[model samples]
Target chain A: MADASSTAKYEALHNGIEPPSFKLPLIDNPEIVTANTLKLVEQTPDARKRFLFTTLTRYLHDFIKETKPTTEEWHGTLKFLSRAGQLSTPDRQEMELILDIFGAEALIDTINNPPKDSVTERALLGPFFTEHTHDVSNGDSIASEGKGEYMYVDGRVVDTEGKPIANAVVDAWEADDTGHYDLQYDNGVPDCRGRLRTDAEGKFNFRAIVPIAYPLLSDGPLGELLLAMNRHNMRPSHLHIIVDAPGYEKLVTQFYPSEDKWIDSDSVLGVKKSLVVDLEQVNDVESAKALGFQHPERGFKLFKRDIVMRRKVDA
Target chain B: MADASSTAKYEALHNGIEPPSFKLPLIDNPEIVTANTLKLVEQTPDARKRFLFTTLTRYLHDFIKETKPTTEEWHGTLKFLSRAGQLSTPDRQEMELILDIFGAEALIDTINNPPKDSVTERALLGPFFTEHTHDVSNGDSIASEGKGEYMYVDGRVVDTEGKPIANAVVDAWEADDTGHYDLQYDNGVPDCRGRLRTDAEGKFNFRAIVPIAYPLLSDGPLGELLLAMNRHNMRPSHLHIIVDAPGYEKLVTQFYPSEDKWIDSDSVLGVKKSLVVDLEQVNDVESAKALGFQHPERGFKLFKRDIVMRRKVDA
Candidate 1:
């Protein structure tokens, strides 16, 4: 009987009579979604962190809200995402680089590790960082024997107060002259890279050839996107380094050559002025012997700087 | 040789640098993408009639943007789309209803064929609307052949200028009281719906059982989403009509029952106040005689509505 009455109503409406309409109960405000996000944040238990979480969540929401793609475009996106997964391997860690390129790496890094104070500077862990490396002597060359120009990088690790941190660890790595890593070498020789723990006076030094500016991997879809934008895909001449100590913070940073053309256009955007220093030429025999150079005619270079790290509370 | 020299130059720089670094560029003042219907107008060459096209494009984009589904949510979307395609058939056109639910049907009707400035209004071509239908006489009943409520829908097709549109083609269709169309019936009976052209004085009348406000097919992924949202999948009671004439403009619109509860929460946001009517009930021997009703004691209802179609050139 109920069904029959409903049937009659449908007939009355479908045959000719019009249906009624109503409007949604929404406020006349500009920030509708922001208000909603704030409401959602209130659902969380932690009151102190609610504002930060809401900010991040709302930012992400706004990011996706604008770049709305169709179902077909979504299919293309999924295909691209699957390829990202397929490209990840032990030898070539492209996933980390992808995260860096998309700014997710920076975002996560900012949240996971903030600066100790307003004066301290936070750093990023770049893609080329590896877990382990062969430790070399202070004066011994870390480069392939007789490969390129001899570089003497001497540095002392210090606290924020400028006091030398005895036994600080400065692990460094750099590509060979051909822009190839030690692992990428087919001949089973590790490239010019090593880990050298600072001495008793917080002093650390290594001898290696400087690395030339090289283009990032430019065969992927990201590379195509860069090419379309007419942007160069090269990082300027640089050396990767990580300084660590018990009482101070670990600083993951890079040193870029001042004259490299690609310095202004480093694709990964990793360059700092404080990290730049000149390696003065040494033609004198006495000076060469002090730095352990055999041939007096064979010119060598001397570089000296200090690594400063922020001191953490617990450390 | 060029590569080798460049490599040497980099080495010389590396040997010369103390600890190379520079100020990192900040990614401040980030811009969020804001695309809407206007984007299509800007990108497309044919900007004159971009209204409907951009509406459709923005509709899809907004749906995807508002529902920021994770990768896992896409599977449900794919399944729902697959079922939408599966629901389509040659004789039974469920695809049209799917389009109606998506507002595509009304959009196409509004764009392709507009109502005349002085003629009667038309409704959308619904899923139950089959091409082949036997035109009945003034007193003929469509419910005599189908199973539904005993209803008599009588109305005249009039112009927007308060004049009767004589001999206008009025195509009509509606589901049974159970909200099921004739095609949903197991037996192959197509007489449940029919077409009746308005008479010379712009008077048109037809007899059919009332259709119930029924829930749409809710077994698919869209259904699941509806259920998750705690929303019923039913639409308000409504009728479909298509008024087409040579001198007058074509109008396609739905007539909705004024008392329909679902009007407040229409799934597709289709119901409009201008389309609703009271659908008055009446019971008299004289009325039965004039309308050719067999059972005067059973009573009948009157639904009167005038469709206003826009003129050709002005529209």
Candidate 2:
């Protein structure tokens, strides 16, 4: 049996701030409600926050007025948000997933990291990227044997002027043939993901499985949202890569295989025309043996491209 | 130790919807991303959802473009929403609280339930209403003794033409002197609330404690939001009531006492000018004795108001 004091703990407590000295008209109508809200928002101490909140309030109010969502519809939106939050865990960011599918994450990325004509275009730093990567020498396999069909990725890190950037660190990861990242598996060891550095000629290479198109998590609200919108949830097959050097702007990007079916509608809206590349089929036994494939007779797909980086000062 | 099959459960699963047949241009720029999103939203099967989502997407995109929040700022917003969701429980609706403070809920109510020229205006149906209420006869006490200073309330339910409505059900509830709902306490029994039917003359009376202005829940993200905006979280003291009868539009409302200090700046934006009323002091001993007070000489505050409900046809 709990006492009154036990329930008293949930009672309202003042936040210590006093009411505003300015007069607020009684909020009898929707317009007055919006007016009073904006006035209160003016009290925000930080200028940036004040501006952001004001803009948000105005736009959100305008949306409500224009759409006139019924009480039921508005409640639906709130419930959707709550369910998304409940489904999210540290390893699975359901909120970011929602933003991604809505193209909000892409918009934010575009606004914050606008393109430089000569530098490699940016893409979403998706939720799958991890710092716990295996360090492999150039040409070593990132995936262990029998993971998937073999693929070789070799690229050169160059400046905007096409000068080789020696010793630039390169990081790469991809989904295996089953369309799942290494982190999705119970095995703790990293696979189909690795880190390597460019050699003297700014050349870097790694052995990995051919990346496969993957679906966004469809067992949650996000999937239901996609179903409601009548849209698919597949991202095109792509290889994730990051190039970093001290004096240069870090390039976070992905190379979508041109032949993949879902290239144009990449679910997260992460596909850029310039970032799409072709993977050439190489069946030469000599080439396979030289690249350290355990089975030289079995040919592999080859992807070759050059990464152009801009100077940090230019960025 | 978890096996590979156990970990596989978290892998992405498709929602079974095929990709749309329409061509989506490569989403290399922000404008293209918005264009593609709007196109995809056109596929919604429901007309209302289509309009609402389309309007929401446009406004949301415009807001993003206008504010151009940096990556950190956008992430902060997402984190704030996530925390609000995580903190919410069945007992406390933090999301609705956020909506209330932001004036979204008020705006929605106003839009959905417009006021009639001659009828009583509607107010927010706050999160505190419960179906479990004690049945009290007219002129009986609703609150247990010692909850707060005594108050007497009598009201009549009438039509738009000012005719008495017999047997109209009137439901009333309020916070105790401590500014806490009976449900907020761990004690399972209900207090400071009741349900009663109007007499043949449409008149109903009951005794309750003097409702106190209460603060919204603090010690959570909502509290932090208020502090950041330099705003207080208090709602003006008021009594919640609902009047319902066959053929009459249900009237959900609250009467704000003009003497409460927080009347002008209700944190929930729930106050309206017409709903404010004066609580007259009645110091007559005869009235206290007639009202069945244990200490007849103490006297009590008096509140009198007539509720006018619109017909369902008019509504």
TM-score (0 to 1) of chain B, per candidate?
Answer: 0.67, 0.91
- Interface RMSD of candidate 2, in Å, is 1.7
Encode model 1's per-residue lDDT on B1-315: one tens digit a residue.
334323332121111211123333422211111121123123333443243234433443343344433333433333443444444444333433432333333333333334334443344445566776667765577665335655677777665677777777877677666677665554455545777777877777777766568676555443543443334567777777788877666777777777666654454445544566777777776876676666666667666766665555654
Predicted model with the maximum lDDT: 2
TM per candidate comes to: 0.47, 0.94
- The second chain of candidate 1 has a TM-score of 0.67
lDDT of 1 by residue, A35-103 (tens): 433343334345433443344445434433444334344334434433443444443334444433333
Model number with the top TM-score:
2
lDDT of 2 by residue, A135-242 (tens): 999989998887788889988999999999999999999988888888888666788899999999999998887899999888888888888889888999999999
Off by over 4 Å in 1: A1-122, A293-298, B1-315
The residue-by-residue lDDT of candidate 2 on B128-234, one tens digit each, is 89999999999999999888888999888988898999999999999988888887877667799999999999999999978998998888888888888899989
Candidate 1, residue B214: lDDT? 67
